[model samples]
Target: MSSRSMLLALAAVLLQTPALTQAFQDDLLQQCGTTTVFSNHRQGRLRQSGVSRVVGGIPSPEGSSPWMVSLQLLHPGMGYVGHICGGVLIHQSWVVTAAHCIKNEKYALPISHLWSVQFGPELKRFAIKEIVIHEMFAGYNHDIALVQLSNPAPYVPVCLPKSGQGFQGIRCVASGWSTTSAAPTTLTRRMGIPGPRAHVHLSVVSSSVCRNRYLSAYNITLNAGHLCAAGKGLLTSGTCLGDSGGPLQCNMADGRWYLAGITAFGSGCGRPGYPDVYTRLAYYLPWIKVQIKKHESAEKSGNYL
Candidate 1:
């Protein structure tokens, strides 16, 4: 059998092995070459195919709102490489994304690699001032981190969900130029090549269901404090690359979108029978607040500070 098949089968077996939890984690790291990149050379073919649609309440703003930001990784030799992960425009200056997206050396994209934050849905860009990853976050903990923009973005801030807010049943929306399917289908099949593909999607999902069902496959650490959002339809709606570091907002009391989660992981791009996962923003508010304070303080101290 192929290595991918072996690992899947192993994962299936370990699902039943209580003693194997450590073993499973080790195997996942070893077999998958577990970096923040989360690549399985064999599984790359599984990511293609997700569908897209417009966000409901938020209409297009004239000349771009200050709210949205696209986090791009810039390598000195490579120029601007776009969207290593998704993030949200919480404050005019600070953006939030998964720590794993900006973590340690294993799959770490260098801090110097970050070039800019492009705002607006059409993706016009701007340079960033600094990236402050949380000091305590080990990245494996999959905590939150921030990217400070050089200038304030013009969009409005979305509502922040309370810390520890479970997305168990909430219907929420995620927006980004993430991944959307070019077409839709019912069957789950893996295709395409082994590198990254762009094109993004926005979708709604059920957190509770996704956490219970695909947690093992998707590298979910529920206690680590992330949220999950299942897709609304089969092969119809969800996130893709370039959609990283974006918002998962819920339709709230005032009919405005409340920031519920940040896009995280999923089995595939709106793959049939699966949900898109997001980082529970409610769980990370303190971290966001702290990071923003540091950035703000730095700005006050000196331009480089």
Candidate 2:
């Protein structure tokens, strides 16, 4: 079997393990403190328009999306060259990403395996203090995780949606270091083939429409926690292999940008009928708050402060 297939099969078996299931259940149900309320910490606006004009996407301006980051894993012989996924800075010390980014198919990898988080256009790397993956995360459902920076990043965080905020028809942009090429399907073929940085403008598709499309074609059912978005122009364009766990950001009418989604998965890169799926931020807001609070409390207690 292919490595990807092997991993998926292993994940299925591990998910059924009683001890693992119980541990995850206990963590999922753990109570959290209520002191710190969740809110976005905006710094200021940039002179450049949030929109990018390049076909794929030009190298992002210095501070355009300061919250964007690259998560890397160090292999025994490869060092930090392996770029596992992308992430967003939700707070000075907190990052949000897909849980699968930090885990293999069978188990959550050790913290030592995580090398660093590269932030901003300069791509300064920072050590990680802690990682908190949602306990209930099973495969694609609840596909979210948080990373705490050993030292706080100086960049301003992107705002999160207010409770119940609607995203339908909103124009959101997806950014990553993935290839700009349009045809490659496998990761190896697209490896290191860099063009302009990827920043594709996409429109949010309604959940019902996205669900129906996936159901009809792939027999997959999408839940409310998933956001579906398609490319804006005639030419097919969206995220690919290296873009997992990156942000799907939307600029609101108030001129503030909010993190609306995290790129999760897709049928193929920029296929005409298949919209890329993201882990909807609003749906997971409560869980996010609880986890952050729990971690913050632990730090205060010197668990890794």
Candidate 3:
């Protein structure tokens, strides 16, 4: 069958299934928090070895981050607009990303269908059904958004935190497209391609430290909702400009990796003092459920259709 026809068939199967939050949480999802593809010899730890960081990011194997989804916007004339931001596959058809990726500075929401999901090795393109930004989002504070896929993605979903989970000071990892600044000033940049897609290890910083540091340097007062993490190792590089909306995953004693944060903003390409900011996933779990259920209800009643 034709590719378009097959995608339509897949979409048909998705529609027949309930997009209800409970069903999505309990039934649709599988054993999450485990990475069989980009896995480690030990059960609880993510693979932090092998790949080396030159400028900032380390090249994570393509399928290593199974839950990472690239959110792209499609244009009519230009077409094929690549990854604008990174996102995590939270539910079968729902993804979590930075709110600023969707909502404009003027608070305008973009047309949902123009955006698509590129997943797996083949970059299977899935259309977007809806875009939901946090109502309380203003400036960069609560920078989180939810996207409903037109069809279910046949990939593993990352686990969400039940509570705050006290992940502070814990080491976590984030994966996304690297920043051009993170690449060596070598032939790749000379050839116009720099900052390959990769991941970075970060030590989650305390909110007080983050607020104190940023408040002094940038005069930005961060609250509890925002998460802060800095690069590990002597080089001290981390999530850069283009890496926004990527998954900031933290592992717990349960031997499961949980979606900890959404890469929100940073001063530069892993600058020394300016640690990358992320929208704390644990802080917004309740709001995420509320938004998902509210919209899922609309979808079931054909209100969204």
Candidate 4:
């Protein structure tokens, strides 16, 4: 072929690359939001009669929450990483978490190298390649972050919400792994097997109702990016576990669990009558997509922050 013809062919291929990539990305996510291990019977029973085991929740089942990711920090003295927060797997190599989990507090940077994510029922670990914090994040204003794992985890990812999916009054479950039953007390940590995890039941509260609750109780106004959720049980108790960045998942009518939000923050490790806050995933899905697309190649290329 002539040089001009060859150049035209190359340009055509280049123009199609992004569209092809997008198609593949969509296909991959299409296979997500499900796991062969999730039992419909077990979840039904739990929903019917789940007792307050950890504060106002019960321990998670082994096959449950296949997309839950435990964020761990390396302990300099202990020489091992332990669960510090929680995250939800959105894609094979991407996780969604609360920005406050790794926010820069003069102690830990948002893009710190010490952070990693542990997932799967076997509890395998993966190194964090890149962290994308919301650019407008400031004191929980935009309290969500996207995490890029160094390699794709061979695990099923939780489904993102359909465009404009509303979550108010929806009964959801928030799952998190912790060493103790309540606020961190003297407890021995475990490894190489399933650790104690809590599956707290919560009901999504409307933004206005949540705002009023916070204002009347704490005398503070909340950001619109946050989701307010009241705890499940008598009197609608809030979560007391205090595991940040955990998933606030709701089981949709299709018998599939969709990731609604991540644990953002709560005052005093949560208490009765108040609703807990979460980084509404639906509100920030666009930001999440842009960050993930922009950084999808970062893991394979040169170093980036």
Top TM-score hit: 3
Candidate 2: misplaced stretches above 4 Å? 1-55, 110-113, 178-196, 233-237, 303-305
Ranking by TM-score: 3, 4, 2, 1
Worst lDDT run of 10 residues, candidate 3, spans 43-52
Q: Put down candidate 1 lDDT per residue, 175-253, tens digits, no spaces.
A: 5542323432321112111111222223444555556666566665455455655443534445432145566666545
| True-structure lDDT of candidate 2 | 0.64
Top lDDT hit? 3
Ranking by lDDT: 3, 4, 2, 1
Candidate 2 lDDT at 233 equals 38
lDDT of each: 0.50, 0.64, 0.67, 0.65
Model 1, runs deviating above 4 Å: 1-66, 103-113, 121-124, 136-140, 178-209, 215-220, 233-237, 240-242, 301-304
Shift of residue 224 alpha carbon in model 2, Å: 1.3
Off by over 4 Å in 3: 1-28, 37-55, 76-79, 105-109, 179-197, 233-237
Ten residues in a row with the worst lDDT in model 4?
44-53
Model 2, 38-64: lDDT tens per residue?
123221111111111122443454446
lDDT of 3 by residue, 68-176 (tens): 8777754455443345677899987799988887775533545786677767655456778888888888887888889998767666788898786657777777777
> Residue 301 of candidate 1: its Cα lDDT?
87
Candidate 3 colliding pairs? 86-245
TM-score of 4: 0.75
